[model samples]
Target: MVLEGLGKSLRDVLGRVNSSSVIDEDLIKDVARELQRALLQADVNVQLVLELTNRIQDRALHEEPPAGRSPKDHVNKIIYEELVGLLDNGEGLELKPQTIMMVGLYGQGKTTSTGKLANYFVKKGFTVGLIGADVYRPAALDQLKQLGEKVNAEVYGEPGEKDAAKIVKNGLSKLSGKKIIIIDTSGRHALEDDLIQELKDIAAVAKPQERILVLDSQVGQQAGPQAEAFHNAVGVTGVILTKMDGTAKGGGALSAVAKTKARIVFIGTGEHIRDLEPFDADRFISRLLGMGDLASLVQIAKEEIGEDEAFEKVAKNMLSGKFTLTDMYQQMQAMTKMGTLQKVMSMIPGMSKMEDKIDYDASQAKLSKYKVILDSMTVNEKDEPTLIKGKRIDRIAAGAGVTGHDVRELLKQYNQSKKMMGSIGKDRKMRKKMMKQMAGMDPNALQDME
Candidate 1:
């Protein structure tokens, strides 16, 4: 539903096909139409989307899929491949101790992403230092210090250094222990001469190994020009898109990668130190198309379901719609294996800002209550939601050690799950759309799963 409009467009084009049969030009055109519409809706540059779709159409009509693949399957796979090809290839930075600079406009997550980047390097076994070169901003130094403390990285800044260049020069001079030194620069609301001069001066001082522009994913189409503007001024080597856990207008970041001739090196899914991930284009666009990011899911599962039994339990439940609160509780616990709820929420686009309004501690406590309720029920009752009637509800309430209302809430959630699965199963349009989404899956892995 998040991609409601784009969903309609995709269904309109891809919905016509139902089997593994060969497709015609009409079908390809329709699929291209839907892709064009979805990309535009996602705030992709109009010219780029058109060009991309044109290539898709040509490939669908001209190229042959692998053996036994259906026409729809062929097109779906082709689109996935071409889309990745359209995105600029990811470039790896030289794995040496060197200076890296963060450049962006105000409110673009420059400082936040810098800290995350530093944390990323530290985990990768690099000693990293931070030079708070944003002396223009009143609170930049303190903010970087607080962030540095979280990552246990060194922060270099004096109490009242007014010149950004001076702070960077001093920071670099004293830098001894770390291989990578990240200089976080200040930004203005728009491109201004003073800020530009200061950035140039910092670059001259640091002679950075790489200068990365931190672009906000929410900026959509505007990301391209903004990236170009910075690239023109400071000559960015790579870009990092942040706030990827929110309603990320994904097209913008993709466009930024395309427009600036700069590769995306990392993405910021959360505000936490470990929230940054190295760029992987195929997985990223797959999720953008509402197909799900299985790689990310696999990462989560590896951490949460370290036990084979636990992994199998949730995977079976997810595919069969037999999920329960106990199951959900285990899933929640699995999620916690990675980090706190607040940190996890920041990784999911729609779930961002959840802690801002939701009662986090209470919500976790509710999960615990539901866990107890499920534990009280017979295994059969846990499997079948419809079987939990009044007497069972009371027994479960007493067993879970919560109010009867709590049992009702658990049933409510289960009902919601059933309704959603049923809707996904019954809708002809949804089936066709989901089939196209199957393109994102690794055919070998899926076959193995089957």
Candidate 2:
């Protein structure tokens, strides 16, 4: 969650709008002012913030609600659109085979971003090859190689080589078979002449289809000038903002780069190798405003679960209200594969609004304890949890190195999940309606669910 503070502020203001009895001039103005405050506090440029707030205010006050749409829903729609307008407008990169060269200043997580980019392509079923053309920084090649290994991509690096252009030329020849070839170029402390020259030379030899400039979101307002400089030097086609998950200044970086010629193509959401996500302004803003991104969630679920019969069976069992502890454990493993609970929740249709209320850290620890408890149960106990009571609970607790209370807690959670799933599964109309709502959801429509 990038710019979480700003998101919380915006959601709170929207919550007020929904609860208000009247949507009038004063309420619109108040919402505008609160939005300005939130964006400014998140390090968005003052001019951009004013411009965005102005648009939101004008639209909300003047635009008539669509037929059957309430004034509150209309205002929320205006806010969602205006906020999305503040970011990238260009079509993102194509998934076909292409050469991509990564460039940026040192310490901007450029090397790590290379790995992330490679992972993104690999997940798309591309055969990725990483070229470690970064020669200046000590261990830069080693780091790239390690990341390449993590993503299972081929790496071509000439260690101790001084000429970056020559290394890229040779590496391109070596890794030409890969569908996606990403060259990680050298970086400097600042936008220096030497670094620019090196990038130019590498681009000349590589003729990369995409020259992506990586920037640290924490760079704040400086991200604009940096992007301009790189784009001028090597015709940077796109930008990747890193460290977005932990930075308040991500809004600044995002807004500033959107002003530049190089539009954001990807964003590094976290430290994990798989945290890089394709930048979609609509989806990004939807998640930010506590409206879920079901498209991205489904994509992640597909990548994690695929067509596993075991998972399908577990899901069916859960829906039938006949799932065992073993089935519950399988479901937990699938969720873990998708992402952190907070991230998964943010992608659900209406769960993002509950993110702040839940204690995810405690919940994650509890899940771990439950896994240990499940591991200690006998096969029969796992299949029929109701059978484990009294003495049985005590024996399982001792086996799991915990008190009987812990075992009971696990059962309580399982039963709750089973009950909820059963209710949803039994109601065919409710399930179909939910699926329809998710399949063709408007941003304003999210408010109804919330």
Candidate 3:
């Protein structure tokens, strides 16, 4: 969700062009102007923004709607395709045995991205290895070692070796069994000659399958120059953008790197080791425009919850009007496993806009509090809440170490959820529709609700 403001602005512009709006020249012009403004505000290069908007405007005005597609849908599709073309490299990484050499300037998150990348491959069942070739940074090897341990990947490093090439050569020999070997090179404060030369020497020794340049999203317009310099020096085959969770200038970095003709292989969405995701421009633009990215949502769900049969039983119970505090607690636990509520919410279509209206941290804390309150309740109270009167409420509140108001809030939420389940259960038509929707969901999604 980097460049949130820009995403909001662009979405608003699209919202204005509803089905009722006529697809005339004036409407296209207005949309083009709004898009230009949003891109500029997001710190995209002026020339690039103009070029993109011009192409969008031309296509919107000239392209004919396909069969069964409305004019509005056609224009929107045009914009989506153009934006994807602007950012995507149109190729995916070959997830086979390969040696990747990571290079970047200091403070660009090169070291952290190395760990994240290693973890990503490990999750895909690759035998990954990390080589600490960054001898200039005193603690680089230690950091890599810790990350390798956390991800259960092997680490090979000569802590005292001053020659980066020698360390890379030795690490390669030691980690020959690894399916994916990542060499973390030392970075400079700036793009200096010595850093470039060092990278060249290491590349010569390692003969990396992919020379990736890690650029911080906040680098803005400078991303182009930096990528060019790296490509000139050691031949950057791909780029990895980091710190994209909330960067205002992420658009600039992405577009700039794309302009360099180096494919963007991955993006660091958050600081967590599991936050690294493969870059897919189409899905990214879809999420940005409030269309959602169900693939990513399913991927995260698969990683977190897997295929839990408990969820299937819960779904059946809910359909049969058997929901209780226990069910709610179990559901909340599953949600907690799927990372932050905001992140989970943004993956659903129409929920990205809701993230701004809700306080995610406060909401998460409330969920935990609700679980604790539920734990303090007796079985009778959890199943038949009407059995609890004022005195019982106070006792439950005291046991849960919460105030009476908090207990009442939980009860209110429980009552609401119960009513919803009861309505769905009683109406056979609604139950059928719900089942159909659940059946359409990906099997790998959080849990199979059916």
Candidate 4:
């Protein structure tokens, strides 16, 4: 969803401009101009915009899409492929037992990204280790330890060490049997020569397969110069664009790419560990021009959500019996991720008409009240909402700041939803159809609802 607005705007303009099926030169030119304007407006570099536009125009004019496909489809494909090519043309990084140095300014997310990348390697079935050479602050060591615990990666650091370079050297020596070692270094407020020298000394010991520079996305044009400075100092092999969930233009990233000519390896979309998206040039650009990108979403879900958790969810539904309130709550959380009812409904071809009746706001509001009621219940009450006799109901109701009837209302809604899911489980074809429909919603929907 990094390019959400850019994608939407391009889609809107294309949808409105052409009514014909023919792939005319004029229409293509118009689309290119509009797209260039859109990318440039998004804070993309002028040269990058021109380069993308040229590639899009050249291929779209000569390309022959599948028979009966809309001209828009071909254009979307060209945009996706070209952007992807621009983004990731280099051979992918070799995945081996070598070090990866994460560098960025203080507060630029080196500490978090180091762990996320290590988590990625761990999820891929690699034995990963972490060396937190950041001795600038004791809080940093704690931060790395907490993140390492979350990912279950071994973090090596000296809490009292004053010299960052010595910490890196000693930490790497202690860690054994790791296929991947990520060293998180101390950051500075700006590009200081002393800091650069310190990083070089650490790099000499680590011999990193990759030295990635993480940067904020809100700096607009300033990102180019910053990337250049870092590249010149310690040599950046790749860039990690962080904080992309906000409305930041992130044009600065484009500048950084131009300045360093380094590949973008990963992007941090949100605060969650699973919010990292491996850079994909093709599908991303395609989506920017209003074509949906499914590749990244599928990868994220498959990697982050364990197969066992998925199996549990699937197995419970197969029994065709009463689903407990616990199950209902889990489903509500999943739906919160999948998307709003109205948005999900819109993806279903015929259900577009039912959008007005979906009552998403009402449903979500009711869900909030349901959670409150659940929190106030005793252990016995949660297991059996029916066992909450009038006296217990009153106590629970007062505890949750709601009427006893509101508690009953929550149970009623949960029961109704459970029955619906149970019913859906009975119809394999319908469930499959609904799942497909849900997948077609925006990627954020998938993340939000699931």
Please report, in order, the local distance difference test score of every candidate based on alpha carbons: 0.68, 0.75, 0.74, 0.67
Error of 3 at 87 (Å): 2.1
Candidate maximizing TM-score: 3
How much is the lDDT of residue 408 in candidate 1? 88
Clash pairs, candidate 2, are none
TM-score of each: 0.65, 0.65, 0.66, 0.61
Could you give the candidate ranking by lDDT, starting with the highest?
2, 3, 1, 4
lDDT of 2 by residue, 358-444 (tens): 565565566677778888998998888889899999988999999999898778767655555555535433443332221212223
What is the total number of backbone clashes in candidate 4?
12
Stretches of candidate 4 above 4 Å error? 16-25, 61-73, 90-94, 290-450
User: Which parts of model 3 are misplaced by more than 4 Å?
Assistant: 292-450
Per-residue alpha-carbon lDDT of model 3 for 111-178, expressed as tens digits? Answer: 88999989888988999999999999899899999999999899999878899999999989999999
Top-lDDT structure, candidate number:
2
Supply candidate 3's per-residue lDDT for 322: 79
| Pairs in steric clash, model 3 | none
Q: What is every candidate's alpha-carbon RMSD to the true fold?
A: 10.2, 12.5, 11.8, 13.6
Evaluated against the true structure, the overall lDDT of model 2 is 0.75
